[model samples]
Target: MRITRALGAALLTLGLAAAPAAADTPSPGPSDGKAPASAGTSFRTAAEIEQGQRATAGGSAGDYLYWSFPADTGQRPTVRATVKLPGTHAAETWRIDVYDGLRRRQSCQYGAQTRTAAAGASSVELACVLRTVRAWAEPWANDPLPGTYYIRLTAVGLPVLDRGLPVSAEVRVDAEDIGGPAAVDGSLAEPLVPGIATEDLADDDSRAVLFGLEPDDGWSSGWWSDRWVWTAAGGVLAALAGVAGYALTRGPGRPSRVPPGA
Candidate 1:
């Protein structure tokens, strides 16, 4: 009996120790590969790039340069951008904005998301660090999920002369995977990437023509969620409690039998 109990305790201890180690293991970062050669003018045309890749483009100061990158669950992505101003120009303010696959603007945790340059300043730098992406989220919650994220860079505040002036911009992104600690119990059915071909929707969808859009496959296929699991568990527990209450509180077996018969 003593040996059996000792063996059982040792196995339990090993199991407990292994779980946390697996959960805490960190995932690999994005590849340090070649960057995109150019950026897109609009969201639909945004040049796709991988994390850790840099992108450069030349355009007018007022142009909206867009870039896109993929992000997985447990990652906290940071976007950095730098704009080189023309030879001579007035003070200008540049800004960088990040949006999820749904085009909803994501709030930055911390970074110089916007910066101003003096008249003689050579360049302005901006960055945005987004919250950790989740495997799944509630329907109402706008938590970041695994998908494609877009970055838009432009001069939000600039003089009229600076609007049409030539400017060069560089953009890059870095995603850090925090591993199992940041992971959720459930995940999305599929990533929020563009599923429909642009040509197929050209004639049927008016929005596609207007915006040059490529829509995402929305949450039609039910996504896996922790709420469903919790609900089922709660229901089972309630049923068990009902059965237990009946067993404990019911009157004793109809008084067993008549006293005379005994």
Candidate 2:
């Protein structure tokens, strides 16, 4: 009975220790109830917004608007955009594209990523539902991962007359947890959010100064892949096997002396 109780206690301790890892990854909480008033025109100038916060901006019809937000592992993020186009006689086509921190374009699982507004139409709505962010992924794969994601909205096709026409855009990002089943065994060593050095912005007064340009070396997750671990393990095994093979195939050592046995 004592042994059984001890075993049960050990099991309970282990379960308690493992509970946090097995629990569902939590979704990012609400923002500070503030909305972004403007958007950026380039990646270097992309406006940063939080989940559940909406951003509204006005720009020319053909201009590109960029916004970014943070996403966590096991969450599927969806970006919704509305373009209130200026009065035009020709149909206009608009698109919303999402990119991970690496600037690699992420494919939408499902949403009207690209839509064409009919001539005389007042507005066009676009959305891109990104794949669930994974805790870790192969180095070569562009799977969504926890990081800063960018949303770029622009008119893909429009008449020349509408090029300089005033237009308004609204963008919002929403993320939902995929729950515990989406959890993976491993996680990134660090999120893909780029670290900006404050020293670089001390002198400049431009918008780029506020939001520093991409690092001179460029953005990287610096994530150590499982492949490296497997490769190292394989190398160790190969060395061991070589050592064993040499020991087994090499000439036998001299036999023990019979004189000492007597």
Best by lDDT: 2
Expressed as tens digits, the lDDT of each residue in 38-59 for candidate 1 is: 8898888898777766788889
- TM-scores of the models, in the given order? 0.67, 0.67
Give the CA lDDT, 0 to 100, for residue 82 in model 1.
88
List candidate 1 stretches off by more than 4 Å: 1-33, 196-262
**Residue pair clashes in candidate 2:** none
| Cα RMSD of predicted structure 1 | 8.8
Error of 2 at 261 (Å): 50
How would you encode candidate 2's per-residue C-alpha lDDT over 144-223 as one tens digit per residue?
A: 88778888999886789778888899998888866445656677876677644344354674322123322222222333
Which whole-number lDDT from 0 to 100 does residue 159 have in model 1? 84
TM-score of predicted structure 2: 0.67
Q: lDDT (CA) for every model shown?
A: 0.73, 0.74
For all the candidates, what are their Cα RMSDs to the real structure?
Answer: 8.8, 10.5
- Clash numbers, per candidate: 0, 0
